[model samples]
Target: MSNISKKNKGYFSEEIVKNYYINNGFKFIEQNFTVKGGELDLIFSKVGSLKFIEVKNIDGINDLFDYITKKKLNFLIKTINIYLYKFDITNIDYSLDVVFVKKNEIYEIYDNIGI
Candidate 1:
C-alpha cells in the first residue's frame, strides 16, 4: 500500500469497506458516484435503509475524524440529495457514514454523522 498510487490506494480501501458491509448483510448499491460538485465513495441498502459512506484512506493521518471536514460533509449532503432525486428515492431511511482505513485495516466508522 505504501508503494501503490493514491488512486489505487483509495480503490483498495473501498473494496475492504465494501466487503465488510456486505458481510454484515448490507447489499452493495453503488461506488464512486460522482456529480458536478461531489462524489460518493460507497452506497449500501439494508432493510429499506440507504447507507451512504464516505471513505478516507488515512495512511498517515493521526485523527480519523479530521478527514471529514465541514466542507466535505456539505459536499456529501448535496450529492446525496441529488442522488435521491435522481433515483426517485422516497419515504426511506437514510444516513451518512464515514469509514477510515489505514494499512489495510479499518480504523474506525462513524454512523449517522450528519452535521
Candidate 2:
C-alpha cells in the first residue's frame, strides 16, 4: 500500500487500541503526540501509572518486530523525553508499550519492550 493508505490504516489501528485500553479502565491522556523524529501513538494512565504506547497494524507476528528497531527505539526514547520535558512530567513512572492490531481486532499487547 501507499504511504497515505498505510498511515490511515495505522490511525485506524491506533483508535482500536485506544478504545481497547479505555475499555480496560485506562484513562486516555493523549494520541498522536509527535515531535521532529517520532510520534507516540497513545498515552494512557491508570492507578497512577503512565504508559507511552506505540500501535502497529500487522498482518503477522513477525511484522511487529519490524517496528521495533534500534533507530526507532532511540527515536522513541528521545521523543518521550521531549514529551515529558515539554509537558513537565518528572519521575512519574512510565513505560514504552506496543499494541499490535490485525484488522479491527487486537492481535497482541506487549508492555515495556525496551532495548
Candidate 3:
C-alpha cells in the first residue's frame, strides 16, 4: 500500500477504536497525540484513571504482541511523560493500553506487556 493509503487506514482504525472506547464509557481526551519523537494514537479517561492507548490495525495477524517493539514502547513511555509534564498532571493513575483492530472486530489488551 502507498503511504497515503496506509495513513488513511490507520486513521480509520483509530477512529473505530476511539468510538468503541467512547461507547464503552471511556471519555476521549485526544487523538493522534504527538510529541517530539513519538505519537500516541488515543488518550482516554474512565472514572479517575487515565489511559494512553496505542492502536494497531492488522489483517490475519495472530500475534498482537509482535507489533509492539522495545523502541516503540520506550517512545510511548517518553511521550506519556511529556504529556503529563506538559499538562502538569500529577497524582493521577495512568496505564498504557493497546487496541487491536481486524475488520469489524476489536480487542483491547490493557497493561499487558508494556507500560
Q: Number of the top candidate by TM-score? A: 1
**TM-score for candidate 3, residues paired by index:** 0.89
Q: Candidate 2 — what's its lDDT?
A: 0.87
User: Model 2: runs farther than 4 Å from truth?
Assistant: 1-4
Candidates ranked, most accurate by lDDT first: 1, 2, 3
Q: Pick the candidate with the highest lDDT.
A: 1
Cα distance off (Å), candidate 2, residue 1: 7.8
Q: Write the per-residue lDDT of candidate 3 for residues 15-74, one digit (tens) a residue.
A: 888898899899999988897899999999998989998988877776777798888899
Clashes of each: 0, 0, 0
Candidate 3, after superposition: displacement of residue 8 in Å? 0.7
| lDDT of each residue in 1-115, candidate 1, tens digit only | 2678999999999999999999999999999999999999999999989999998888587767678888989999999999999999999999998998888999889988983
Ranked by TM-score, top first? 1, 2, 3
Q: Residue 3, candidate 1: how far off, in angstroms? A: 2.8
Residue 84 deviation, candidate 3, in Å?
0.3
lDDT of each: 0.92, 0.87, 0.85
